[model samples]
Target: MFLTNTLIVLATVAGMEAFAWLAHKYVMHGWGWGWHASHHAPRSGWFEANDLYALVFAALAIVLIALGTSGRWPLQWIGAGMTLYGALYFVAHDGLVHQRWPWRWVPRSGYLKRLYQAHRLHHAVHGREGCVSFGFLWAPSPTRLRAQLQAAQAQRRAQPRQAPPQRPPQADTRGR
Candidate 1:
């Protein structure tokens, strides 16, 4: 039963990870641009719509747990796997990749670098369109990723800045 549970959890986690990648590429970066846009905006805000995706996933977990309690071992295992994956994603994406908190050691693996590069590509643009690198963990090559990141940064810098809109003259409230 333990082995079966382990296998089920592993498979479910893998599926969930893949689904996350696809959703990031399509939904989050595509149709869901309204929420995710805050992430790319120059100035930071107190709340971002991108967080709703996490909330939705958490709600899904709660539902899965409720359903799994009724003699559904497979479902329970899958739920466990998803919860684990979320935790891992938080640690990897928010913690390691983004450096939201202060941790000094950088990931040394080539694969991890690739994943970072992919994420960098995702952040390279402000709108819904760009190269998609949605996986929370796993990058295949660091050098290539670094190159891509540099290129994207250069491209962004090369774009011309727009001037502020002109305002119409207003009547004075007080006359001399």
Candidate 2:
């Protein structure tokens, strides 16, 4: 039972990375931008509007935990996994990367460096549309992220802009 619960927690944590990537790419960047836009801009106070997402996820975890405590199996573990993921996200995304916390140590090398670089590249775009590196815990190589960003920018540039409709010339009916 212990091992099974532990495995569930581990799997859930891993699964969250993939889920977060998809949500970050589609929801956060798409229709949900009204809330997520705060993250892209300079934060005015200690909290940004984007923090609502954390609250939503935290509420979900709380509910799952409550259900589990009420007798449902595995839910507690899943909730624990989510809580753990949130903590990790806080440390990596908010603390290490964004310097939201007092500790401002930049990663000198290794996976931390890659993670740092990938997220930085994500913000390389001006708006929400062209960003890359959506995942929080997992990040691709910096080179690959850079190439993808460049390709997306080039694609945008290659597309022709539509000209405004022109008014057709009318006959001189007033003279008649």
Top of the candidates by TM-score: 2
Clashing pairs in 1: 111-139, 115-139
Query: What are the TM-scores, per candidate, against the unseen true structure?
Result: 0.73, 0.92
| Tens-digit per-residue lDDT, 12-58, candidate 1 | 78898899888887887888878877666653554567778888987
| Per-residue alpha-carbon lDDT of candidate 2 for residues 20-138, written as tens digits (9 for 90 to 100) | 99999999999999999999998887999899999999999999999999999889999999999999999999999999996689999999999999999998897788898999989
**Model 1: C-alpha RMSD to truth?**
5.7
Clashes of 1: 2
**Per-residue lDDT of 9 in model 2:** 92
Prediction 1 global C-alpha lDDT: 0.73
Candidate 2 similarity to native, TM-score: 0.92
